[model samples]
Target chain A: MIEKTLKGKPAYWIWLAILGALIAIGWACYFRQYAFGLGLTGMSRDVSWGLYISQFTFLVGVAAGGLMLVLPYYIHNYKAFARITILGEFLAISALVMCLMFIMADLGQPLRGLNVIFFPTPHSMLFWDMCVLWGYLLLNVLCGWVILTAERKQVPPPKWIYIFVAISIPFAVSIHTVTAMLYCGLPGRHFWLSAIIAPRFLASAFAAGPSLILIACLVMRKYADFDAGKEAISKLTTIIMYAVIINTFFFLLEFFVGYYSEVPGHIHSLQYLFFGLEHNGEVYNNLVPFMWVATLFNFTGLGILAYMKIFKVFDYRLVGTAAVLIFLALWTDKGLGFVFAGFVPNPLEEVTEYIPTLNELGITIGVWATGFFLLTLLYKIAIGVEHEVEQ
Target chain B: MMDNKRRKFLKMAGATVLAGISAPAIVKLSSTDAVASGGGQEAAAGGHSQSAAGASSARIRLGMVVDMRVFYQDQALLDVAIEACVKAHNIPEIPDRKSEIKWIWKTGYENAFPEHSHNHRSQILEHNQFAVLCNHCDNPSCVKACPTKATFVVEKNGIVAMDFHRCIGCRFCMAACPFGARSFNWQDPRPFIKRYNPDFPTRMRGVVEKCNFCGERLALGLEPACVEACKGTGALVFGDLNDADSEIRKVLDEEFTIQRKPSAGTIPSVFYIV
Candidate 1:
């Protein structure tokens, strides 16, 4: 009882209060979406999908980061990651929740989402995607819970927990690949209809995902007594660098195919996405400049990381800046170009632009804030539990 | 003890997976075997076959023929076709917007005949108003991609039918259609029910809709609205291709014709004479 009482400082209450306020604001916005139909969104006949899908794609990549820690710790027996596996599992739970929230926000009738199960369409890639996401989430949640319970009870975790972790590594990769198949299977949309799209998504996801974990490690080290070690950080960044290199290669290959074919229909979409199409000004501007900026950030951050001497200064600031830039670039590319630009010169060869309305923007912000607030509360509860057990 | 539990768990999982994968295949194969047995019994008993009775009309091949010459200078005729369709079908007016339910629309000389280069190009430009609708292709791509049995090419009538209720709104049919004939209602269209087309059914939001070749009117011994409204001067001809003496057959025998976007390999039922 005294351990529980000692766990919460005044600062914990402050963080909790701040998070509660953000949750309130986000919930108010969610209510507004229920009042109005999907007309509140920027989606139209030309561009049926918009911001919600883009957010979902980004969050799924973040969730895939859990495997980065889990794979090394379990299969490879990297003892350094043992203490941090709980943190990774908790982060996976938060990321999966955000992914589900974004998808639900994008649906026409959020309540009818369960119909996906009642009436399963095996031909739809979405059904497979849903199964993979739910499976991965449950795998991590169960793995974390059983392990943590054993730790608190001062006993070895059930041997079956490692089996779950072993299964989850490949399951993690499958989750993001199934997500990529959602767009890659379409024949007409040249931008998304490539075989390499899933690999590219995984590459970029791994790159940005590990960078986020590295940043989280730095922060926890500073505030808490958790030191994940410099060697682990270095090793994680090296893996991230390889992912970035592959991601850059994919971007170049996509451009080469588009320009080489010189097929007006295929080339026109890339031109519209990267450089504005004839007379359509700054429609996909956020995508073109920001994507290149992302490439530059990845290269520059990797360059900084290459120097062993600079390892001493590899604190939250430098790692945080790199993570923000990489995350921002990828988020813009997937959200803006992947969703809206596919519709500019529609199948009829008519150029109709899609711009999200105010209501859509409001609801999107609410969804994001809700995700953040939920993550904060979950982290607080987790950290508090860890402290109580330690005492 | 823990190892024993793990091995047992693995065995249980393996059995579950094996059942999941093979159960469907076994069911599918056994059903086919039953059908094969049923066919053998029918053949042995000498069943009264469908082909023996009314074998001539065994396949009702539905088709349409449009004459461009009558519509060359008649805007009133085109207006009548559109208005008559709107009235007969109870199509709601979109109010300065184009709805997915358009049964008729006019195309200019350049768009209508991109390939045909006649010596009388000036004469052709002076008079050309072509109304375009669904080609109702013989080898339709739209029918191939529909996940549900929502969109299909009817074997008996040679017409395409869209079952809206069965549509999961995947919109694969829309992207597959090369002609851009399909339309998706982004928002609720039922509230825009100022005027309703009784002959043609209104569609819900999220599902796709297109010109169905006026399946209701074709059920009766009458022509489609657009075909019937073709200036009443043989601008549009409708008849069975199977009937050698039909008006479509006479037109095909007399005039040289072209189908839209022949490169697509759709083999359209609608034809145009230059």
Candidate 2:
């Protein structure tokens, strides 16, 4: 089973080598951060949380998005999804690895990381988030490993694997909900306190997760002589189309409530994100550009997906392009827009902008590389098992 | 006259440390508390430990009432108070505004009372610089956010305390504090501490810290260093809120007082008299 991932073309090894170099550089940069302090990053007294935390928030959605496929195939018994369910599960395992890595990179004291567990605080949302994340990661690892191994042996998976599958269905939803709760429960941060934050997270997760998988499936089809079938691809495109609509609708609802309610606490962050908030006669709207770009991408991606669904067109390239657009839009909206909105015009009605330094960016890229490295291996093994068993 | 008293107080604290009357676990081999300055937060005399003996009665809710009129009249009074606190606690003087650590700070009405600053307000209120520090809330959001119990409210004294060694420096507390009270040591703080107070310890990098309501001073049967510095000014008052006859309670009852972000439901122990 392990040998499948080891045997690859020169292009594959070259890609791995590049990632290996990035991982090495990222770790080297992290060591410098550890020796110095978080001062190496662009975060400050007002904008306390920056790139690492925002990235953690976005990737949690990506990990939770894997459940869209798992729930449909296992519970609803959607046969069209059977060909790609393994892809979703493997993607989850890879994304969770990145999620955990980003969290470690953000910690001020990574060595005392166990303190969260050593002093298990049930009252804290972080305590619950840690519990749910590890639980979700373990469940996906078990489900993916067992299902794929069983497929290669040409036998049915253990009857008990469904119980884990059943648990993971809710686990997927729980991870994003718990992650949102981390921000929402803080009374001071008005931007994160929405009742629909968890739902918004799930919507974006559904959109982003499948978008990446759709693009990955297309890549696998071209590079590895593997086809996930036309029906499965079309079904996934429709799922992404609906997810994008829901995600965009959720954003519009936030916009309506922020402006219509006319609450300064509620509107300040949104104002800062979209148009820039004025503080002390200086307009502190650094996030304005990225946020506007996200808004454009979201509506444009939404328009394209809606048009495709209505026309009943599923050309691989057209759908692939839409998926890329939707994925980037959600990533920026949450990663760039949401987290900064929470901190700008900080508690004191003062603005302190955050811009990640090169060192922080290096560590971030390293963490992402590690995640992709895991992903490439998992996908390779899953596909190899499929090829060996299908023959 | 006050300078002599401050020197005497520092000498006594130094003498106590030299005599080694405290538990060996005290952060500094001197009786300095961990939260006050240095390491071994879970060890004795780290602010939360019962070793802070005389004031360990759980019934007492410590509180402060700020009379802004005194500071408004003589701004130097406020400056002296801030200097006293920074010196006693060894707060780093980081040049970068973002990374600077503060136990107490001054802000105008626009920042001090963000909710009330919009409309045409009092010129007097607008001019006076309000002193802000940790609210040490009765129901603190930071206590709930900390992944590790590094920061917790001491039930006995009703004071929020930090264990520097235990803090993983996640900065969740910074976000949880509505008043922007907490500061993270972004760089090694040792270099920035200009005047080392042997009576207190200095913290390392990568930990969150803020005003402890002078818990270490209270342990030594002295008022907080800031209160002591402002003794004659009538600007800053510290007393046990639970005590019916305490000065803070009387001040609160008589004056029109306010707390930062009352709607956040933190129930700040610190109050301001407009």
Give the winner by TM-score: 2
What overall lDDT, based on C-alpha atoms, would model 2 receive against the true structure?
Answer: 0.84
- For model 2, residues A1-391, the per-residue Cα lDDT tens digits are 8899899988789889999999998999999999998999998989888888888899989889898899889999999998799999988888888888888888888888999988888888888999999999999999999999999999999999999999999999999999999988888788998988999999999989998998889988988777999988888878887888888788889889989999888899989888988877889888888888887887787777778778877688887778888888899988878887799788888888888999999999998899889999988999899889888
Question: i-RMS values of the candidates, in order?
Answer: 4.3, 0.8
Q: Give lDDT per model, in order.
A: 0.64, 0.84
Candidate 1 lDDT by residue in tens digits, A1-391: 1143235556656765776676666567667656555555666555656777777887788788778788788888898776676777777777888888878776654565675686565666677888989999999889887887777676888997888888899988998998888777654556676898888888888876677677767766766555667778767767776777788789788888889987665676778777777742434443466556655765676665554325545554665566666666666666566666666555445556666776667666666666665555555555555665669
Model 1 regions more than 4 Å off:
A1-32, A222-225, A279-303, A306-313, A385-391, B1-92, B95-180, B198-208, B219-223, B231-274
Which run of 10 residues does model 1 chain A get worst, by summed lDDT? A1-10
Model-by-model DockQ, in order? 0.11, 0.74
TM-score of each: 0.75, 0.94
